[model samples]
Target: MAKQKIVRVDYRLIHGQVVAKWIKYHPVKRIIVADDELKNDEFMCDIYKLAAPGNEVDIISIAELEETLNKKDDDVMIIFKDIKNAKLALNSGVKLIELNVGAVQNGKDSYFVTSGVALSKEEFKDLQEMQEKGLDIYVQPIPENEKLSLESIKNKIK
Candidate 1:
């Protein structure tokens, strides 16, 4: 099985920071984006593929992601666009011991945890449950940024 080096929640699945910064720190051989919507959108998938020129980029559904997690042998970085998909992957048996929160676009009822990350009450609850289940969840937009744990952001959640 592939070593799951990083599991990041970024609304912009594969972009500049991922290619120019995160990869510099993690050096992943494969980038698997686990989002049902992206899995069905060929054009968007192609864009992400172009963003990460040399690496193997795959936009797969949550189910296919589970299979990939079970069979692959490379160091992989899994990206989920939303907390729901991340929770789906976790429930599907993807053992993500640590999850990095990047940029999640603001929405109604969402509270800002950081300039880049905001979470709604429901989303915050989901993350809290994940944390309770042994996931070390934190917010770190880039390699240079200090990671802020869920506990630090708890009070900010609306």
Candidate 2:
């Protein structure tokens, strides 16, 4: 792989922060979405592609992504729709040094995780597993704002 860009877990695949800031600010050449769900969903796939106009977005399944190994630049960002899917990709030999916990949705027994993001018990469990594997997980919505580091965010769990 030329580079192993960011591995972010976001329910919403593409957003303004992703296109405007992460892609433009950091200047990533490609946006790789490694999610099996989105890979199969035609509507979501179309949405992601259309949402990122003038941006190179590759939506690939975990199996397909594992066989590939080339980011071609330092600015590429690898994103996943959920933590579980991203975990699968990472275990498949994708080196993700930094992980961005983009957002979590509201649900029963869930608590406020970060700005506009909440986590249910099941989601929290997946997050704990990622932390155990030593991935730097943070809850940050916008790139420009101050971010919540892994240590700081983890402290809020227990």
Instruction: Candidate 2: list runs displaced more than 4 Å.
Output: 71-74, 154-158
* Model 1, CA-based lDDT: 0.88
Per-residue C-alpha lDDT of model 2 across residues 121-142, encoded as one tens digit per residue: 6766777677788777777777
Shift of residue 2 alpha carbon in model 1, Å = 0.7
Cα-based TM-score, every candidate: 0.96, 0.83
Instruction: Give candidate 1's root-mean-square deviation (CA, Å).
Output: 1.0
Q: lDDT per model, in order?
A: 0.88, 0.72
Q: Which candidate has the highest TM-score of all?
A: 1
Q: Estimate, for each residue in 7-107, the C-alpha lDDT of model 1 and write its tens digit.
A: 99999999999999999899999999999888888988888899998899878899888788777788999999988999998898878858898888899
| Prediction RMSDs, each to the true structure | 1.0, 2.4
Residue pairs in collision within model 1? none
